[model samples]
Target: MAEVSLQNLEKVYPNGFQAIYDLNLDIANGEFLVLVGPSGCGKSTALRMVAGLETITSGTLTIAGEPMNDVEPKDRNVAMVFQNYALYPHLDVARNIGFALRLSGMPKAEIETKVGEAARILELESLLHNKPAQLSGGQRQRVAMGRAIVRDPAVFLMDEPLSNLDAKLRVQMRAEIARLHRRLAATTLYVTHDQVEAMTMGDRVAVIRDGVLQQTDEPSALYDSPDNVFVAGFIGAPAMNLRRGHLRSVDGDWTIQLGHNRLPLADSVLTERPALAGYDGAELVVGIRPEAMEDASLSDNNAPRIVVDAELTEALGSDMLVHFYLDAAAVDTGDPDVLDDLEDAALMIARVDPRSPVRSGSRIELTVDTKRFHFFDPKTNLAIRS
Candidate 1:
């Protein structure tokens, strides 16, 4: 395993389209870093650049402290698992996994030994003789992983490897991959559009948008304190509820006015984020996480409370997602996935206790953890925290 570093890496197509900007990242030895973003966000392009499959327009790429900008893909000492599995139909599982070793003229006995070890590691020993047509989608992807595992390269690169599988299989494979990474402890760079995968599997996640690097941090930190509106809205499952509101000071106290409703801001909020005081009388984006809101009837927490009519309700066993319409207009965070959601500008979602008896069109009182609320500049879209 080796450390990989991208120092101001860049990629531009022949058609004068820049696929990636000046992006810089460092993956420590044996660390699994995931580059994640939406469709056409240059995540795949960035991974390809690291794999040497795509040319770097500028900057430097180094593995194990050695520069590899001009190295060919085969000589880069990196193994890549593509999205398609890319296994030959005629070859059995063992042969397919050992094909790279065979190309390098490894003896048949040694090749068998390596293939056997990888097969055992992947639990594919029972299907060593089976062809691709005889294997399930998850098994086929395992074969693809086996092919890379036998190489024992300095680094591993995977590009949207779970996208081809069914939803259930994808979740299963995700767990398998996480376990594999823990056992192998290889320096791996994975690319995916799914935030769940990024949050669950990676030691750290790098979020990109429109060829520009947005934010890179651990999942919890990124969720708790996003640097900008884009990162705040992009990293969560239901995404953060972002709405435009005015911060006003009334009688020596600050309060956020969302359309017609007003919520008193605690003095501790200003004490923590002193910069927020400068936004008095200005419109800023307020981000409310769904999980931070709960059914006011269930608990007696000291959090602020609000009452709204539930527009929709989805029960997921563990929790109930109550969708309601607020008076404030939703803020556009420049995320394409949430564009359609903004059609109803006032829609907001809250995740409440499953035991709460709330249904669609029912008026429910929701409590919000106001101290945990995120505030962002309306013009710059950057978070306002000191």
Candidate 2:
């Protein structure tokens, strides 16, 4: 029901450790915005500042068109759901959900009605009498959400609320939370380290790194057209295959010298990124998504082809992942999660048809979709797009 804005937001401790720097963002009313980044990337710190839990070193925080930099956490009208359920073990679900209402000195009857409504919405009416210790992890999380819902806060702040659950439970809870958001239409700012969760949940996602904002865009835009090397490597499932390549313009045609192979660049590739023409005969970074490369045997299009020795193949029902090494140096995009040793630094994965008979140590041909290839400046690590 309210919009949140952070302009020039900054958080610096007395010890001179700056966790966030000159951050700026605008969350529209009834919009779900996710702040996603690696661990220790200051995402949680930014959220705490907006909730009035952390003092702003220098910046402006606004909610509902009113300044909130000096407002107390309780006065900000924001309900935060932490990773831990943080429910009282002795109190049953009903009392826990209505605790805030009771503290506000609301009538006992009114508290009961509000608690009942939240319980119905969260599908916890049957377990109203059960204590926190008796509920499952998912149930306990729902109790936390119900508690926040009864307050009818102006903004909902959730910090990795699904991290404690199992993978299956996490998936289930993701849908549940998204459904709840749709029904309530409350302004929400969700913070998480998981890229998949951010892509699936948020209307728009903000990627942060080293306490600086990277790119904010829809899931598809982030996946298809990353603004920089870091964003390109961080957003995908099997992170993008980025390697050093030399661009060459022979007569009127263009080609990329990728290690031992020479792949023809399509005309549309240059049409889409006219800036690539400037990098002729120069070294640049090349990025290819797993799906952009397919088994040459299965495809009929006359796309550019490359031969490689398949180091491994993983059969994943619908598609097979072929891991191979291109005879090129891999570009490090500063993602701590990518642990590529020297021997495996140039490893590339291709999502191909599962029916293909590609095995380890076998030579296979792959058709690369030249039009879908991404190019980045080697020095700046930025995408070469017009």
Candidate 3:
């Protein structure tokens, strides 16, 4: 295992199009770091650059402690598993896994030992004799991974390796890959557009947009404390509910006015994010996660309640998601990939206990966890915090 570092990395195409800009990243030894973003965000380009598959127009890239800018892909000691699996269709699993070693002229006995070890680790021993066409999608993907593992590379690079599988298979493979990484403890850089996959599998996640890095941190930190509106909105599943609200500070008390409703801001919120005071008497964006809002009927007495007309309801076993319209403007969050049902600009969703009996066309009360509310500067689209 080896640490990888990218300092001020930049990539520009032959046609003068800049694909990446001043990217700096570090992956610790034996760490699994995931790069995630929408399509054309330069995540793939970044990975290729690290693998020596793409040239670095500017900046420095180091693998372990050696400068690798001029090194060839084969000498980088990095193995890449592509989205298409890239297995040899005519070759059996055993041959496919040991192909690299054979090409390097390793002894046949050594290749077999290495391939057998990888097959056992990936639970593909039963399918070793099967050809690429004979194996399942998951088995083929495991073979692709086995090919990389057989090399025993210092760093592993995977670009959307699970994208070809169905949702259920993808879920199952995700667990397998995570387990494999733990067993090998190899440094890995995985690329994906799915936030859920990034959240569940990564030791730390890096969010990129338009060829520039947005934020990188542990998944929980990215959710609990997003650096910007783009990261906050892009990293969550249901996504945080963002709306423009007018900030008001009246007689030492703070409140946000959204249309006809005036919700008090908890004093602790201001104490933690002292920058919130700067937005007094101005418009700022307010972000509330769906899980942070619940049925008022089931909430404690001190929770702040808001009355809204329920537009629709989606029951998902453990809880119900009640969609309602707020009297405020919706934020775009600057990511073109996010498409929602905010046609009229006031879509809000709340995750509530299913027993609360809230239904469409009925007026329902939702209690917000005010202390956990997020505030952002409208001008900069950045979170307001100390």
TM-score of each predicted structure versus truth? 0.98, 0.98, 0.98
The ten-residue window of minimal lDDT in model 2 covers 337-346
What's the best-to-worst order under lDDT? 2, 1, 3
Question: Which stretch of 10 consecutive residues in model 1 shows the poorest summed lDDT?
Answer: 338-347
lDDT of 3: 0.92
lDDT of 1 by residue, 8-43 (tens): 999999999999999999999999999998899998
Model 1 residue 238 lDDT score:
82
Each prediction's Cα RMSD? 1.1, 1.2, 1.2
Q: Which candidate is the best by lDDT?
A: 2
Give the Å shift of residue 209 in candidate 3: 0.7
Native-vs-model 1 lDDT?
A: 0.92
Cα lDDT tens digits, model 3, 225-343, are 99999998898878798889998999999998877789998889889988888888999989999999989888875777899989999888898999898878889897776654456
Per-residue CA lDDT of model 2 for 1-386, tens digit only, reads 79999999999978999999899999999999999999999998999999888899998999999999999999999999999868999999999999888999999999999999999999999999999999999999999999899999999999999999999999999999999999999999999999999999999999999899999998999999999999998998888999999999999799999998898899988888889999999999999999999999999999999998899999999989999988877998877777446555578999999999999889999999988888999999999998
Q: Candidates 2 and 3: which is better by lDDT?
A: 2
Which ranges of candidate 2 are over 4 A from the true structure? Answer: 339-345
Report the CA-based lDDT of candidate 2 relative to the real structure.
0.93
